[model samples]
Target: MKNITYYLKATFSWFVLPFIVLVLASAAPVKNDVSEKEVIRLGFIPLTDCAPIIMAKELGLFEKYGVNVEVTKEASWANVRDKILTGELDGAHCLFSMPFSVYTGIGGKAGSEMKVAMILNNNGQAITLSKDFCGKVGFKQTGKVASVVAAKLKADKEVTFAMTFPGGTHDVWLRYWLAAANVSQKTAKIITIPPPQMVANMKVGNMDGYCVGEPWNGVAVKQGIGFTEISTQDIWKHHPEKALVVNKKFSETRREDLKNVMKAVLEACKWLDNRANRKRAAEIIGKLPYVNAPADVIEARLMGDYNLGCDQGIEIYRDNYMLFHRNGETNLPRKSHAIWFMAQYMRFDYLKEAPDYNAIADKLILQDLYKEVATSMKIKIPEDDMKPFVIDLDKAKFDPNAPADYLKQVNSINQ
Candidate 1:
């Protein structure tokens, strides 16, 4: 009788424990429904604009949003683009125009659709000329530089300039600056060099000048190899620069994951825009695994303390500095900004004909998604999508409504 009772109790215990375990499992909340932990990988190059993504990971903002993120340091913009295209990386700190170019099949393998979830930064890049061109061409004097290049071409030599990527902000800025001086980009050779390699390439006489983002430009000046001829802000004040881009497939299938990621990055950008945190931010991003430069080298530009380094004295530009979040202005993924970039694509003959500007802008720029994230964060959204504005140097107003006419007015447009 005792043996029979013990057997009965053991059998009853198994059934009761299984039922309780099932109930508890059903009651537990789901943490990340969109993606599994340790699955998402974000790529970034070693530049200042990559700060938000880095900060997001370092500050545990990604974790706060219940998303696991691994930030991968990329070597070049092309690598970043290719990784996104091949699905090796989930997203990256990319050029503002890169996704558009990929969408249009400008420089990628084919027309692989991509999306710009948000603009990463603006007004931090500059045109750095080699020390060799110091005395010959002054800042913003593209005409003199053109004349020098023309003479070089006349002597059966090549005048080469480098940008970070083709159809990128650096390329567009360099081309626009040259065109303003009546120099045809066709007359000179333009090469693509990665940002981190710009200073070293210039040092070896590989290129006459390069247009790239901060720390590299700052690195050039500090190494006495190059000088800043003009900043991108000087080209067009508060012009768009880098963006957070992702594969279109990822965006479509994993919308919630993307939203959470954007929220974390937006929070990071807000933290960076605070002037008081910049010094600490600089130190954090300048470590060997990140920008891999000295904190002071990165901080000077981050704080708007410019040392043009071509016998041009220092200039302080606190208002038009590299801004990540200016009361939510910097975070807006404006369609007008997309239209402007498309206009440049048309200008440079990247597109044989004018694209459906509005359609393309609407498709590639995730403005509505950006708004949702911004609103949830209590950040103000822009009242309108198309804001009419003029670039400071050009003085010609850009109307997103009439991109074709604006392209015609541009002296740089290739006929």
Candidate 2:
């Protein structure tokens, strides 16, 4: 009787244990354990615009807000995407267009996505052309070549242009520049290269041009491998750049913690806008683990001075430099911007047809959450949703209220 009882009890224990373990693994936690057990890991690529995340961590902003944040440096945007999706990172300093691209199967598994918590910074990125084209295209701010050099370059050799990711802001900016310059998409090759590797790739004669954020473009000019063909701001003034994108699961399970994180980052954003602290900000990110460049190289560009290189002289941006907070308008994740990005995907034919713009924006941009954080912090939210805005280089306008009209305009452009 004792042996039978023992055998039955052992079988029940084995079967029940597995079920209990599985339930615990899949179930959500009842109590918030952010400060006690969980440390939110934030990842960033080594670019000048990653300053907000690094500053928030360095200036004790995250700690002050009652959340623990570990800022990790990532090699590429792809790594950032993988880590965020795998739960290795709670959030990241990501491209504004990445979440949209990821949701539509350009950058991630189709229908799977990271959420845009808020905008990080705006208008610091630029398109750099290799030394090969320095003489022909010297800082074309409008980026309108009329195929003067692009066609000739393509005709001479297999001209290649690089961007950081597909369907991302860099890719779009590069594509926009090409289209605006009348370079047929078929005539030139557009490839993906990681941001940091851009200058080196150009150094080794890997690609002819690339669109990337600072201080890589700064590094390229500093290294004498490339020149600033066109800054992204010139392409579209105050265009959206990096974002504070949170993992979907993190957003659901750790709402309060995420808000606190945004509050801290908001403080850092305001700090960055002061401009007086920019040198120190540059010093922080230029450290080995952050941007890993000379503080002077990063500082000059961060302060709105672009040594455009190629004897084109410096292009000083007083109002349109790398802006973390531009009188409170830079941080809001504008729905129209989302619509424009999706339209760009269609414009470049990355998407054969138009995506559901409103639906995707609603899913990705955390509008209500951002507003809550902004209101609590005494920051006024900007009312720029679904508004019509025109880009700098071209007259082609984008009105998010009527996306079809915008699509038709972009569709008419020479691809």
Candidate 3:
């Protein structure tokens, strides 16, 4: 009886132990299918709008999302473009129109397809004139500014203006302001100066005025070297500005990694949009490796407290200030914005002929990818990606469907 009992116990133990092992093995969690990249190298220029990328690195948002990110401070937009194209950098805080220009073959040597993953920020840039023009031209008074330019031209004195990049937001703002005043940008010398250098160049009388992103604009005002003629917001409220961009190959090959990076940046953007966080955000990005500007300089404009430095006194425009993630409005990679940029390029003769606007925008903007990232974050995605918006200049409505007709009606100095 004892032997029979022992045999039965042994048999039960063998069957039960095997079944337990099999159940545990089957229940173990599956390894994540998403490929985790070891390191992501991102490039950025020393401008206030680079806050999203800088804050992401400083706040460990990238690591929080399982991405190891390294932020490189690039010297200029040209350098940023080159690094992205050559894979020296994985991605960059680039001008909104930059990827479009690159993809369309207008920005560099040859056309290399590029992608604008997301918009970094909007409406922080300003058009600043040297102190010499302080009493001569006033804010948003483009007609007076044009008259001054005309007078300078009549006297055989050269009037030079600067923008950060040829087809960049700064260039568009400066050109739009000039054109609105009947001052042909072609008639006035338009030069490209790095944003950080705009103040120094103005002090040395290299340029009469410049349009650039902060804190350089704020720095100029603080240094008493230049004054803000107008904020970019005045030209077009909440205009699309800097973007988070990458090469097409990178976007396609490392899609998961790109999505992770975008998720990190979106979090940073949300953090920055909170007015309570602006002071801290300014402090972080103002560090030596990032913007390298004074915290006060970066914080003021960042919080919508503008001195204008034109003796116009301080003005608080909280609602119309630079925005990062206004409930996802600022970050959406809208195709309409891209269409407007292409329209500008064509209007300025950057493109000899208008390529398929929707096609180019669809190829470059990656709205669907943005939607995927935003949705995963529980951020509300706008139902209509393309909406008709009006610029403050002429109140001319821009219909994404008929960009060509809008271009025809657009008051282009290039024409």
TM-score of each: 0.88, 0.89, 0.88
RMSD of each: 4.9, 11.1, 4.8
Model 1 segments more than 4 A misplaced: 1-38, 140-156, 413-415
Decoy 2 TM-score against native: 0.89
All candidates in order of lDDT, best leading: 2, 3, 1
Write down the lDDT that model 2 would get. Answer: 0.87
| Candidate 1 CA-lDDT value | 0.84
**Candidate 2, pairs of clashing residues:** none
Q: Residue by residue across 217-328, what tens digits does model 2's lDDT show?
A: 9998988988888888887889999999989999999999999999999999999999899999988899999989999999999999989988888888999999998867
Clashes of 2: 0
Candidate 3 lDDT over 1-415, as tens digits, reads 9999998889878898789889998999765332355778999999999999998988878877778788999999999988998888889999998877777777776467768999888798888888877767775444233445523533556788899877888887887777777766667788998888888899998988899998998899999999888888888888889999997788999999899999999999999998999999899889999888999999999989989886767767878899999898888888988888888888877778887889888878888899999999999887766879899865779999999889888777656
Taken over the whole model, the C-alpha lDDT of each candidate is 0.84, 0.87, 0.84
lDDT string, candidate 1, 127-202, tens digits: 8887877767765444233445423434556778999888888998888877665677787788999988888899
**Candidate 2: minimum summed lDDT over ten consecutive residues — where?**
141-150
- Going through the candidates in order, what is the number of backbone clashes in each? 0, 0, 0
Model 2: runs farther than 4 Å from truth? 1-37, 139-146, 149-151, 411-415
Worst 10 residues of 3 by lDDT: 142-151
Task: Judge candidate 2 at residue 176 and give its lDDT.
Answer: 87
